[model samples]
Structure formats: structure tokens, C-alpha cells
Target: MDSSSLIASPSLARRSKQLFLGTRLKSEQLDETMLPKRVALPIFASDALSSVAYAPDEVFIMLAVAGATAYAWSWKVALAVAVVLMAVVASYRQTVHAYPSGGGDYEVATVNLGRRAGVTVASALLVDYVLTVAVSISSGSQYAAAALPALSGHEPTVAVALVVVLAAVNLRGVRESGALFAVPTYTFMAALLGMAAVGLFRLLTGTLPQVESAELQVVPAAGFEEPLTTLGLLLLLARAFSSGCAALTGVEAISNGVPAFRKPKSRNAATTLLLLGLIAVSMMVSIIVLANQMGMRYVDPHQLDQLRTADGSALPAGYDQHTVIAQIAGALFADFPPAFYLVVSMTGVILVLAANTAFNGFPVLASILARDGLAPRALGARGDRLAFSNGIVFLAGLAIVLILAFDAETTRLIQLYIVGVFVSFTMSQLGMLRHWTGRLREVHDPRTRHRMLRSRAINAFGLALTSVVLVVILVTKFLAGAWIAILAMAIFYFLMLQVRRHYDQVAEELESDEQDSVMPTRVHAVVLVSRLHKPTLRAIAYARATRPNVLECLHVDTDTEETRELMRQWQESGQEVALRVLHSPYRELVRPVVAYTAELRAANPRGVVAVYIPEYVVGRWWEQLLHNQTALRLKARLLFRPAVMVTSVPFQLSSSHAALQRRERDLDRARPGDVRQGRPPRSFTRR
Candidate 1:
């Protein structure tokens, strides 16, 4: 109500929010939160679109296991992966249309298959999103190293820093972060598409330059040198196909983020999904084809004969294996070096932005799970920027830990990449099959039934294909590192089940309807006094204001001199309230208070005992530490006693008033539109 309050309040509130979330937004301002298609494409599709940077390399790495002889089939593997990508995109389009609540596979499975199936899908998607961040950022760091040799040996540290930066950006809100990322996403797309076009043009004109590694002969693994057996070839091709399918890992992100779209959410999301599929598949297939036409060979950096000059002699040490996109760019732009650098730079930027897709999808999915009682309820709450802030930080922490553990090596991380996604894809498609089957049972119209059957067929085909890919991925990458992902999924699944169980048990126990609205027989009030001071006098007055059936002032005698002085002061003050001293021979405070409260509760089961403690409300941080520690400890110990309620009679110092004003300003700024929700502004109330 004062001028200083009106001025200082807003400034302090703005400073607090600017320190944390950079800006403060009102509740009504959230209507502008929906994303336009251009922004949404970058946010929801970055993971899939950026996969082209590393998916082809994964394919080539698997093929290199059998040496260059097996590289001939790499394009076939890429094509097969592209087919699966199209199927998944098509299937998820139906999902977004049918269930646009942003739950994606978890919602679909729960609605169609069952709760267990839903939990299974949720678990897999959770693991998939985390791996999406790890693999994408790790690969981005690799591209960074290639672009700047000075950063060659610090990929993991660079990757962690990138994650931290991304976490900060996303904390700014979905639409804001989306706008921030749009340029990089689109530029990366244009760079890759332009490079692919130029590479294809040169190839058609028969002027395509050979990659640096084209002439280097790959030394095969021990068992692969001789003529391949039937089983050996099948296993090798399966590995290649499985690795190629990493391109499909992030296709579900659009489905998970359907709610973040503008008007006509489902249609926009489906369109985005289609665009993601087309762009990703085209770039992936084009990169693999160009790499093949240019006779490029990608192998593990530690592989034998990875580098050889035109004379077939070994090149010098510390030679980095640039990524698939980098190699293709180098080959296509042999005469124009900047084009290659442009491609590489954009590739690295996009790969880092790729994690933004996971940042968007994971928190939304976790929010849904939290709403359904599977995750911590805090994850369901939005922060100052109206984003699921807790979930975002949780994901960033998990990803950073994984990056540190794996040293940000894409080769090791990619092995753990596609397993969870394929599990989610297979189960989601299967759930959709059941969804359509149930719909067919209800649709009496012939035309509608026909459409249902068609959708069912599509989902069924997706189910079969993804199921087979899941099996192949599991078998081929199990020991190679996929087991880590599988174990993670299993752990999340069981943990969520336990969380749901705990929530259920808690709900059942807290169910109200009570024993005919029974009331306590009487109210017994106790004032905890440390000394005869204004705070103690205030506590006594508040206790008297309650007009309880019984009232007493209690003090714990920790020191004889202090207790005697307090007794003499009470007598001299002529206080009517009787003061009782409790002996604490062990020099304890909280224990004696807790025991007395418990004893009172036991003695009067039908009565509610209210314990009022005097507390100091301080503004400064160190001032807070100087006071309230004892009051907080006592309150914590007293809360567990049945039929006992603890109250704090706070004595506000001058500093406390300042803190109160700042808090009021913050609340006012944060909930400016709370009146629309029929709630009054937050103002301090005094008794």
C-alpha cells in the first residue's frame, strides 16, 4: 500500500525471475504458447532430421565388420531402414490423429492394450528419449571435433556443456526455445539438401571426386576374411540393417509432441511427421548413395588399415575419421572447400539441436505420466515459463550422467540407441492394431468398417516390421551395449509400476467420507517458550485467542540459571498463565518436546493438542540460518504425532517485512491472471 512497496516490489520480483527463468509470464499469456508449423518442425522433428548426420555412419560401421566386401549391401540396408521409417511415420500419423493429447505411444497402448502395456511403452519411450539426447549430442561433439581439431580429445566435456546450454534454453519455454532453434534446424536441412543435390549432379555428369578413404582397403575381421557362410552373411546384413534403423529412433518425437502444435494440432503434427520422414529418409539415402558412388569407407577409428596413402602405406597417427556427412561433403566439394566446412558446421549444429527434440518430447511425456500417477507429481507441474521444468532438469541430469559414463562416444552410445525406440514402435503399432480391431467391432457402417480394416492393416504391417527389427536389434547389439538400454527400460518400467502402486495405496488411505464427521472432544493448547520475551508473550496471546479448553506454558529446562531467571521473570510479570518446567537432563530440546506432545496425545485421544512455538522470520539468507533451526527441528519431530497440530507464531523483524514484500511482488507477477481463475491476490494475513 506504500510507495516504496509499490516500487521496490516489482523490481525485486523481476530480478528474482530474471535470475531463474529470464522472464516472467502471466497465466493468460500461456494461450500464445502453441507453436507454428515452422517452429514446431524444428522442435519436434530435429531428432529425426538430424539422424542423417550419424545414421549412415552407423550403417557403414556395421558393414565394415565384414570389410569392404560387405559395404556393397550398405545401400540396401539404408533402403530397408527408409522403408521402416516410412511405415512408422504413417502409423504415428494415425496415432496423432486418434490421440492428440500428447501421450503418444503410452496413451495409445494404455487405451487399447492395457495398463501394463502402457507402462511398457512409457518405459521404452523414456529410455529412447534419453538415448536420443546422448547419441545426438555425442555425435554432434564428434562433428565438432572434425570441424575444429583443437577440440579433438574433449568430446565428452563439450557434449556436457552443450547439454547444459540446451537445458538453459529449453527452460525459457517451449515456444521461445522453438523459435531459437528454427534457424539452425532449417539451415542444416538446406545445407544437407544442397550438398546432396550437388553430389548427385556431379555423379550423373561423371565428375564426382573420390573420397579420401576411397582407395584404402579395409582389413576384415578375423572370421570375415575367407568366403562368407550363409549364416555369417545373414548375421552381417542383419547388423547393418539394425544399425541403419537408427535413423528411425526419433520418428516418434512428433507423435509425442502433438499437443504443442498450433490449431488443428493433429493434422499439423501428422504433416510434420510426414515432412520429417521424407526429409530424413531422403537425406539418409542420398548420403549413403553418394558415399557409395564416391567409394567412401567409414570404419572405427581404431580399425587396422583405416588410413593409407595412394601407395597403400599407412598414414600418420591421430588421423580422425570424419562423419559420413563430412566425408560426402568433402568428396562433393573438393574444389570449393567452404562448402564442405559449411556442411560439416551445419551438421554439427543440427546434431546438437537434435537434442532439443528430446527436450521437448521427454518433459511432455513425463508430464502425462505424472498426471496418471506413474511419475513424481512434481513433474506434472509447470514452472514460471509454463514448461515442465522439473522434468527437463531430470532428463538433462540423466543424459549428462550417461554422456560422462560413456565418454560421449557415438559408437558405444549408438549401440544403446535404437533398442528402446524399436520396442516402443513395435508395441505402439501392436496397440494400434487392437485399437482398430475394437473400432471395427463397433462400426456398423460398411464404409467405416472398411476404413477401420485399412488402418488395421497398416498398423499390422508396422507391427510385424518393427517387431522383426526389434528382434534383430536385440540379438545383434545385446552384448555390444544394447543391454544397457534394455536394463534401463526394465528399471523404469518396474519403478513406475511401484510408483503407481504407492499412489494407489495412498489414494485409498486418504479417501474421505470419514466417521460421520466426528469432532475432537476438546482443544488443548500448549505454548513452547524459551524465554520471557515479546515472542513468548505473542505466542501466549495467540493461544488465548483460540479459546481452547486447556492452556499451559511449557519450557524445557536446559540450564538451571536460565530456567530460574525465566521463573523469576514470569512471577515479576504477574502472568496468569501457569508455566510448567520439563526436565531435560541430557541437554536436549526437540526430544523432550516431542515426548510431551506424544504423551498428551495418548492421554486425550478424543482431544486435539495444538503446540504453538515462537519462530523468528528473517529476510536475509544468513539471518535465516541464525534463527528458526530449532523451530524447524521441533516442528518436524512433532508432525508425526496423531491428534497433534503444530503452529508457528512468527515474530517478524524489519528484514522479514522486506522479504514479505518481495514474496508478495513475486506472487503478483507470477499469477497476474489469477483473478480469471476466481482466486484473490496473495497478501499477508495477520491474526
Candidate 2:
């Protein structure tokens, strides 16, 4: 190798390493304190808590269509939805106890039902994770507008901004943000209870007043006469109740995150499940009750004209409808400005933070799927803190796409919600039943038998309730947009099955053969040269360095002029090797190369053909696109030929110098044993 080539090798290696930075993590660094209960709740259950932010708003919005008469059903629907949530929480609590390894619904279904069912559960949960971010962020932005008037008419911008921020925090690692957010998440619950108590006291004293906007009349959309039939009214009530049940969406997160909990993992997970459900239920019920008392009315943003002014004229355009929790905050803190803003601000912040649950849950679940060989191996890659970095980026891309597509409107996005939650709910409860049945035969104690039986009954009831709700969500929302979610689930299921098949096929192919250790009968070295440049010279030298027999220079003769000149030059230079030019009338590279290799392999079936091609190494990442077109294609075609081996003899040009400098700087900034490694990479440490 020349002096210039020697320098280039180190430069190219340095740059190649940069693409892989921040991707590798040590497993040992992923420990328990990384997931304390407070942070874990926000990290895992924020999706559930944030639902209370807008689920109540939807309840009031739908009911207000029928005038004040519809307000009476708010608490009833909230209680009914809570019953389902409580049952689901109880079932998942059993799930965590039964399977503390952290696969959650997907694991449960796979263990009990089989692989297909597990894939179904996985697909469902994947869809749910995306919806969790979309719905939560959009709803949070809705709340943000109420607290700060400047945010009006910019809901999508605010929602997407929040999603972007949440994605960054989650990509950093779950434990870090969990520790940071535990107080704020808990405060959301505390604030809801405190407001509920204050509202109750004011009600008892006959001093509770309605919200300022609540008195504005809500004219029903251009649909039916005011006096409706019992069946029509009940169906509308069912639709409203089903929408409200979005509050139950994130209850299964604890089951998914049991492995993140402290020792006595099952117990801790179960207790967390209980805590999340109770807190979510209380907040949901309180908001609904308060909205009803305040006489709040809302409608689909597109149907705002339905809400008329007191004089029977249309309410003005651009009239902002504050959500239920916002309305309650405005009413309760009418006298306390700071208290009012704090509740509204945190409520908005918590909504965005709620997406954190999806961010953490998605990557973890994806890693499990990848480990099981049912997803792309990239999903298995962990971050510097041993978190699933690829999975986080994947979730962010999906959420961002959905946000942009739907314009981050909660009203439109809400239609796609709840389907994934119910799918997992029904499947998990079924898995739990199978779980208890499997455990019953192994247990000898009578107390154990009785407790198992009780758990089974609760799960069975939960299954029944969730099944009904799933049907209701589908019936009411399928046309409205839930079909898109169902389609997404189906697509994910099939794609995962294909991934598993690919992994299995690869494993089978990679299995050792009896002749794997055998040396080749002959090593035929072919130096593929396109031009007489530094890269070509480097390729020839590298191939010669290997010192193989039957060494020859092969070129695809696309045009007459280049091949003749190359041959003349080879002769004039008195080169030791002969130049063999093959004419290609079609001027194609990959096909002719493939055909040539096949011919060589046919002549010597037992021999190995090692083809060396010179490739350019560039400084800027984008500069890579400008080079290596033919070599990349050649490598790809050669890969399919089992007998042919391809090697890249990279020739780094001076343009690659910048990339080398950047890597050297990065290495210095984050050297091993440096204090900057405040958190070790968990992925590398684990394996």
C-alpha cells in the first residue's frame, strides 16, 4: 500500500464508526433505580392518566348535543366505564403476577394460545401505542389553548411540538425521564382530587356556580328533531359512553412493564396497576360530574354551527370550546389566578408527558418481539442507556406521520382510538383465564386454589365487559376512522409473521454443514476495475496482497473506447497480469456480472471466486450517495450467488478528511472512562 492509502484507511474507519454511535448500550446499566415507582407510573401509566384530561371533555361534548337532559348520563357512563377499567386492572394485575417477565399481553397470549395470537396481541398493542401519543398530545394541546389564549387556533402546531419534545426525552432513556416526571404526574392526580373536594364542598354549601362558557346554549347539530325516540337516544348514549371509555385505554401498561418494577416485581406491578386505575377512575368521574354541574357544551369542531346563541343566531366562528377539566379549573379557581393557571398548565404538560408511556412501552415491547425473531433485528438494538433506541425512533416517526396526516386534531384522531386497547384487553383476559387454569393443577394449597379461582372469575367478567366494549367501539367508530387502526393492526401482524419467517429461514441456512471447514479447491481472484484511478490501483494491490492463484483483471466493456485504451495501457505498463475485457452489448452491469460469475462457478463448482472491487470513501455522509453505485450493485448481485464472495477495497480520497476529524473530536468528547458516561450503555452491558 502507498503512503496515501495507509492514511486513508484510518480516516475511512473513523467515519464508518460514527453512523453506529449512541446506538450500542451495556445491559448491566439497565437497573432497578432506573425505574422507581413514581417515574415508572409516569413512564408506563401516563397514557391512562392523560386520558382523563380529554375523555371527560368528550363525554360532555357528546351529551351537550341533546341539551341539559343529556348531562344526567355523564356520571352514569363514567361509573360504567370505571367498572370496565377496574375489571381490566384486576385482570392485568393477575397478568403481572402470573408473568412478571414483562411480555405483558403478547407474552400471555403466546404462552397460552400460540404464536398467531401473540402476534395479534403485539399488532394490537403497537397500534395502541401510536394512538396513545396522537390522542394524548392533541388533547393536551387542546387544554393548552384554554390556559393560554395565545395558543388559540394553533392546536396541531402545539400538539406536534409536544410530541417532538416527548420523543427526545424518551429516546434519552425511560428511567431518566421517569425520575424527572414522577412528581408532575402524581401532582396531576393530586390536583384532580383536590379540585374534586373543593367542588363537592361548594356544591354542598349551594355556592357552586356554573362555568362562564357553560351557560352558552348548545344547539344540536342539523340531525334530528329535539324530541327523539328512546332507541335513537340510547344509541347516542352508547356512542358517548364508548368514547368516554378511552379513559380505560392505558390500564394494561403495568402488565407490559412488570419487569421494570422493583423486587417482588409482581406485587409491585399489581399495586401500581391498582393505583393507576383508582386514580384514573376518580379523576375521570370527578371531571364528568363537574362538567355536568357547570352545564358545559361542546361539539365536533366542524359542527360548531350547531351551538347557537341565546337569541337563536349562530355562535360566532373561532369560538374556542375549553375542555371539561379546563372548564372545572376555570370555575373552581375563579378567585385564585395562580392556582387556576397551575392546574391548566400542568394538565397540558401531563397530556404531553402521557405520550412518554407509549414511547417507553413501544420500544420495550419491540425489543421483545425482535428477540423472539418476530420483528426486524434493528428493533432489538438498545441505546446508550440500554434503552431500545430504534423502537423509540420508529414510534416517533409513526406518531409524527399520523400527526401530520390528521393535522393533530383530537376530534378526528379520537375516532381511531380505543380499538387497540380493547383488542389487547379481550386477548389479555383470555390469556389470564388460561393462566389460572394452568396454575390450578400445580397448586396444592386450598387457599391458593380459592384465590386463583377468584382471580379467574374477575378476569372472566373483565373479558366479557371488554368484549362488549370492543364491539361497541367498532360499531360506532369503524366508519368514522377506527377501520384505519384495524387495518394497521392487520398489516403489522402479517409483517411480523414475515419477519419471523425470515429469521427462521436465515437460522436454518446458517446452520453448520459438515463441509464448512473444508478449504476451497482453488481461490480465483478477480479484480473488477471500472476506471484507471486510485481506487482501481488500490483494488489491484489489495487483491494481489491476498496472493491468490488465477488472478485476473476483469472489466465490463460497456463502450469500445475505454476497454481498448485500458488494454493498451496494461500492455505499455508491462503489468504482470492480463486484462480480460468482456463485451456487454446491453451496457448493463449487474446482469452481466451475475452471468459471468455463474459461468466461472459452473466451470469450477468446488472452487471459490473472491472478487475485489475498489470503492470511494467520502467525508460528508451525503457524499456517499455520489459514489459506489456500481460496486454496491455488484455486491448485492454477488450476495445471491452462494459460491461468489465480494469484498470492498475502500479507497478514501482527501474529501473524506472532514469525516475523520469529526470522529476524532467525538472520541475525545466521549472517551471511555470519561466522566461524561454518567450512564453506561445498557444494551452492550447486557449481552
Candidate 3:
């Protein structure tokens, strides 16, 4: 048989995939996919930027538990979050320059701390990435429901669909998805900042109108009817601050994606990190301040009982409270409805695109873990589009499961957010501190030492801030949902440790030895036969061609009549190979064959036994189920015997001719990446 006939041909599924994902690119074209600064911003920073849409809402929701009086502390909380965001961004800038291989925190922790520390950081990041997708898409679904009432009561379905679409877009390739998403991300930034600017101007001119919720009175929850003491106030403020820290969820993506940037990758990534921090902080603080000044009141969506009318009466039935951005936009552009819709719509779009950051970051981190033997090797393979497609699909599946489990409720899912990210942040910053401290000892020059010391200070400050934030998040949200994230991190850590151990064991077991080079003393060949047909003849001829020391045809006697017919056909065919029959009184096929092979191996332990099984090749999938069952079982049993080699000789059926022709046609057609691979047009002329 010609080897070319075995090559798989392009099928309907392959064509459909090409149509959906676009043409495939060669590996040599990977450098062509590198992102510029403008594109990289939206690809890696969209999550941090989009956090403004919900971070402010979380802050207000946390404070609303103590009535509207607590709203005054919103700006202070926002300021603290901004300070931490800046410090983190500064710390990661040093990280990118020091280790620009796209390993980000995992690399820093592994090199400086140890493999366990690195695996810890990797687990934290993985959990956080999945949560990022779930939370962002769920929030987007909320906004979508608010904008289109028809989508109400079906947020989970909508969120799941959105996740699927995002996964498809990302599967196309990073550069293409980045380009497709750049407009929405940028428009979101412009709309939000522009609304803030307009609102500030109206405030100075004494013409800013109050939001719809301004007249509504907030009812304090139980035990908070009066003013609080210092301890109580501090605890309440800590909860609010922890919720607001969601703004810093995506700041580390730039460091994780340094390799995706163009030349001077580290410098470009560091600059993008700075831009993300500045933009995200500016938008977050602006929303918080504006909402406070405009008397924007927000509570948990499910807890509408906390709100009352201005007349001290219970609110109307089914009163929908719009999000902070929606209310602010509605008031800011009361006269022009189009501008209001633009701001609100773009907010929703950005929330969904924010998941793109996780799509980009999670796969890169998973690939790094794979290279280090902590993850499955499949996660490190590039797909047709030169993307980490296996990792992308894995992340999408996880996000979808979370969305379905939580009913796509943003508030509920938000409780599980921030814990994993902060864990990675604190560990990475601590690792950086050690990294700089060790570097300071080796540097002799005064200038270099001073620079290292400065970097060390920045990392130290970042470590302190992130560690405190992490403790606050765990304390405030443990009962809420943060423990779920912690449990997930622990599971991932243990699984990865086991995976590394398994890989190490396999490597040690596969090490070459002097005995591996020794040749077998003799070769005994056995051809499995059932029907003494064309397939059996081909297997026997191929076995004979190998010129073994001994060869025979073995058949199991299950049905007496069938066995007699096979023996008669063997005699008529007049084959050179001898025939051996094994009787099975219980009508078993696999056991009798296995017992015979074992006896042969025990007789000559120094010789190698070669078993050739004839198989039928069918084109249709259903036809495959009707054939190859016995051969498959025999091969499985024979594979376990030491010094035994199994061979499969396939006889193609008439149905397979169509597949052979299709393969030939596919080979003649030119593919998309052929030019980059320096391959000429393929032409096959029949003689």
C-alpha cells in the first residue's frame, strides 16, 4: 500500500473550520502577528479598564448597607484603590524588564522562590482568569438586560452565548481579535471619560441635574440604624475598600503578555502597564466622585427593599435600579438620548470585551506552566491560527460552567473575584523583593546598586499594599464566596504537583540503558486470521517479507463450521505459512489468543514475538463500528507482553476510494501559508 493513501484529506469539517477561523498561518508568520502599542492596550488592558463599570457599583453597594451617609467615604476608598493600582503597575514594570519571557509572576516566583512558589502563583492566576471571564460576561448580561428588556430573566443564557462568541473570536488569533475589539474598548474609555468631564463642567457651572435615585431614601440594614464607633466604621470601610480593589484585577496582564508585543517587547509592555493604570484609575475615581456628588444610590440588585421613596413610603413594585454608569449617563445627557444610549451601550460592550484580557492572559500563563511540566503538553501547542487554542477553549469551558452554576448574577460572582489575583500579586511582589535584594549583593557599581535599591523599594511597597489588601479580601469575603476561590486554587496546586511528579517519573523511567541496544536472538512472527480473505493474505505476505526466523497463521476455533471453512480456504490458497489452531470451548476469542501469545513468549524469553493483525479501513464512521473489534482486542492484549511487537496491516474497502481521491485533490490545492513556507504550487500529473 502507498503511504500517501494514509494521509488524511480535507473534509467538510475542515472547510467549515477554515471558513470560521479564516485561513491558517504558518509558524514562520508568528512574528507578523506581534501587536503594536495601540492594539496591545485593548488586548491586555481591557479588563482593568472595564473594571470601572462595576468597581464603583461594588463600592456603593458595600457602603449602602450603612445607609446613604456612608457614601461620603466612597471617594476615599477610590483613592486608596488608585494608590495601590499605581504601586502594582510600577512593580510590574520592573518585573517585565527583569524577566521578559512572558512567564510573569510564575517565572519570578520559580526562579527566586522555588517550584512550589511558582506553582502557587500559576494556580492563583488560573483561578483568577476563569473568574474574570465569568464575572465580566455576567455583568455585561446585566447591562444587556437593562438596555433591552426582552433579554430580562434570561441572563444566564445570554451570558453563555456571549462566552461562546468571545471564544470563537479569540480562536481566530490574538491580532485579529485585538483589532476587532479595539474600537469598543477605546469607545468605552472615551464615553466614560467624556461623561465625567461633562458632569464636572456642569457641576462648576451649577447646572448639573440630580440622578433619578437622588430623591430615594436609603434604609439602613439591621444593626446600623445609628452612627458607628471607630471600630465599626473601620470595619465597614475595609469591606468597601476590598470590594473596590476589583479595579486592580487585570493590571498584571501586560507583564504576562510581553512576548506578544513587537520589538523592544519589555519596554512596550511596561509602557502599556503604565497606560492601563493611569486610564483605569482616572476612570474609576471619576465615576466614584461623580456618583457621590450626584447622589447616586445603589444596592444589591436582589435587595431592592433597602430603597424607599422620598415620602418615607415603600417604593413602587418592580422598581428597577439602573447601574451607576447608566444613572450617571442618563443624568449627564438628559436632553440628548443618543449620547446616553452610546455611553450605556459602550459600557455593556466593554464589559464583555473585558473577558478578552483573560482570554489572552490565561492561555499564555497555561503555556508557560506546560513548558515547566506543571500542565498538560497540549495546552502549549499552537493551533492553525498560531494561537494557544487549547488553553482558550479550556478557559471558555470553565467560565461557562461558572456562569451556569451562579445563574449569571454579577453580584454573587463578584464575591469570588479578586482573591486569586491578589494572591498572585502579593506572591509576585514578594518574589521581586527577594530578586532585587539578591541582585544588590552581586552588583559592584554604585549606579547599578542605587537603581537596584530603588527597584527594591518599589517592590517592597507593592508587597505591603497587596498583602494587606489580600488579608482584607479574605476576611471580608470568606463567608460570602472567597473560600470557593481559595479551594479552587488549592486543587489546582495539588493537581499540578502530581502532574510534575508523573512527568519526572516518566522521564526517569525512559532513560536509555546499555541493554536497550542489544538485538533479539530470534524473531517469531504470527499473523492473526479469522476469514482467510484478502486482508489475511496481505498480512501473511507482509509478515513473510520481514523474513522472520519463524512465521505461522493463528486462528481461534469459536464456531466449528466457520473454523472448518477457514481451514478449507487456507488449504486451497496454498500459502507458504503454516496454520495453527487454538480450541476455545467457551467460545471466547481474545482470551485464547492471549494465552497462546503468553505461552510462546515464555518458551523463548530472549526472542521477540511479532504479531501482525489485519484490519479493514472504512471511510464512513458507522462502517468502522462493524469491523476491527477482534483485531483491536487482540492487539490490546498482545501489547502488554514483553519483547512482543504489534503490527497492523489495513486493507482498504471500496468505500475508502472516495477518501483517497479527496486526499489527492486536497494535496493539489494550494493552502494559505504556503508562500511563507517557500513552497511552490503543487501539481500532480497521472502517467
Best by TM-score: 3
Cα lDDT of model 1 by residue, 433-530, tens digit: 98898888788999988877888888988999999999999999999889989899999999999999999999988888876389889888999988
Q: Relative to the true structure, how large is the alpha-carbon lDDT of every model?
A: 0.86, 0.80, 0.91
RMSD of 2: 4.9
The lDDT of model 2 is: 0.80
Deviation of model 2 at 454, angstroms: 2.1
Q: Mind sharing the TM-score for model 2?
A: 0.86
| Per-candidate clash tally | 0, 13, 0
lDDT of 3 by residue, 1-687 (tens): 111123334576688999899887889989989999999999998999989988999999999999999999999999999999999999999999999999999999999999999999999999999999999999899888877899999999999999999999999999999999999989888999999999989989989889989999999888899888899899999999999999999988888999999989999999999999999998999899999999998987888889999998998897989889999999999999999999999989999999999999999999999998999999999999999999999999999999999999988899999999999999999999999999988999999999999999999999999999999999999999999999999999999999999999999999999988998898999988888778888999999999999999898888999989988988897877899989999998889888887888889999999888887776666666555477666677778888889898988888787778876677677777667667645673332
Arrange candidates, best lDDT first.
3, 1, 2
Question: Which ranges of candidate 1 are over 4 A from the true structure?
Answer: 1-16, 306-312, 658-687
TM-score of each: 0.93, 0.86, 0.96
Worst ten in a row by lDDT for model 1 = 1-10
Model 2 C-alpha lDDT per residue in residues 1-687, reported as the tens digit of each score: 111222222434544443343233467667733565666677777788888887887777677667656778888999998988898888888888888988999999999989999999999999999988988888778777766889988887887788777777666567766877787887877787888889888888988878866656677655654666898788778888888998988787778777778777888888888888988888888778877777767666676776777677877767876667767888889999777777777788888888888887888899899999999989988766567879988998898888878877888888999899899889988988988988999998999999999999999999999999998889888999999999999999999999999999999999999899898898888888776667877788888899887798888888899788978887888778777787899888778777888888999999989888777767665565555477666777799997798888877777677657755555444445434657534433456
Q: Candidate 3: which pairs clash? A: none
**Top of the candidates by lDDT:** 3
**CA lDDT, candidate 1, residue 316:** 70
